[model samples]
Target: MTTALRILLLDDDPFMLELMTDMLQGMGYENVRAESDARRALAALPEFGPDLLICDLSMPDMDGIEFLRAAAEAHFDGSVVLLSGMDSGILRAAETLAMAQGLSILGACSKPVPRTDLADMLARAWQQREARARPPAHGGVK
Candidate 1:
C-alpha cells in the first residue's frame, strides 16, 4: 500500500474544500489538511508543510499565481498544483507564466476535482518530486 501523504488543499468555497478533503481521504491520503480561507492557508503552510499543495485559481485574499510567488519567497520547496474553473487555455497560459517565474508547478486540474484526476496528478507529482530529490548519479567520488 502506498504510504499516506500529507496534502494541503486550499479553496475559498467551504463545500468544495469538504468534498475534496473527502475524496482525498478515500484515495488513501489520510493526512489531508483542508483550508477554506486562502489567506489562512499561507499561514498554515509553515506548520502543515504538506508533501503537496493544491490551490484554487480564484481566491479571496490571493490568487493561485500570487500565492505561488509568495510561497517561493517563503522558501517552500514543494510541488504546487492549481485548480480552476477557468478555461483550460487560460490556465495553461498561467501555468506557463508560473513556470517562467521558476515556480515548481507539478500540474493543474479543473474545479470539482475528480477522483481519477487527483490520483493521477498526485502520482505524477510524487514521482517527479522523488526524481528531483535524488542525488546526481556518479558521485564526485569518481
Candidate 2:
C-alpha cells in the first residue's frame, strides 16, 4: 500500500536526484519522479499529485524556500521532507517557514540522508495519510 504512494524528488544536482531515486526504489517505492528544476517540478505537481515530496534546499534556480512558497500558492497538500547540505539552523528555518505556510512538512535532514531515516519519514507520511483517510469516531454524546 505504501509502495503505491506517489513521490516527487526535487534537487538541482543530477547526482543527488539519481541517488534519491535509487534510494526510494530500493525502499520499495516505485511511484517516484525526479526533477532537477524547481519550476519544472511545480509545473508537474498538478499532474503528478504526489503523496510525498523530498526536496533539496540549495538549487541554482528557485531554491527550496522559493519552491515552498510557490507550492503553497499552488495549494500542494502532500507531505514534505527537506533534504539539504546546509547547516541545521537553515533546515530548521525552512521547516518552520513551511509549517507557517501550511505545508505538511514531515521533517528535514542533512544531505547524505541515511536509508533508515528516509524509511522512517516515509512511514510517518503513510501513517499520516491513513489517519486523514479514516472516518472520525463519534462518542455517544448525541
Candidate 3:
C-alpha cells in the first residue's frame, strides 16, 4: 500500500493548532503533527519528514516567516501554507520572501482558515507532489 503523506502544522495558539489538526484528521490526513512551539516545530521536520507544512504567520518566539527561512535552509522541499490575520502588506512581503527562498508556498490565507479551505489546500498540495514524483515521458532514458 502507498504510504500516507505526512503534514506539519505550526501555530502558537493552542486553539488554532488543535482546530487545524482535527480538521486535517477529519479530512483523512493521518500523519498530521501540530506544534505550538515554533522551535520544536522546526525540530520535528527531520523526525516527521512531512510532505507539507502549514504555519501561522504571527507565532510567538520565532514567527512563521523565520521558521520558513530556517526550514528552507535545512533543505525542506515540502509545500508551505502561511496562515495569518495580518494585513495584506505583511502577507505580500512574506510571499516574496518565501518565493526568494525557493519554498513551494501553496498560498497565504486569512486567519481561522476554514476547514474546507484547509482540505482544498491539502488536496492541491498532494496532487502537486504526486505530479512532481511522476517519471518523465521519456522514462529513465531521459
Give the number of the best model, judged by TM-score: 2
lDDT score of residue 46 within candidate 1: 95
- Best candidate (score: lDDT): 2
lDDT of 3: 0.85
Using TM-score as the measure, name the better of candidate 2 and candidate 3. 2
Stretch of 10 with least lDDT, candidate 1: 133-142
| Tens-digit lDDT track of model 3 for 33-138 | 8899989988999988888999889977798889999999988888989889898789888988998999998888888888778777888788877877789877
Positional deviation of 40 in candidate 1, in angstroms?
A: 1.7
Worst 10 residues of 3 by lDDT: 1-10
What lDDT does candidate 1 reach at residue 29? 82
| Deviation (Å) of 58 in candidate 2 | 0.4
Q: How far is 29's C-alpha from truth in model 1 (Å)?
A: 0.1
lDDT of 1: 0.79
Model 1, TM vs. native: 0.86
Ranking by TM-score: 2, 3, 1
Report, for every candidate in turn, its global Cα lDDT versus the true structure: 0.79, 0.92, 0.85
- What ranking emerges by lDDT with the best candidate at the front? 2, 3, 1
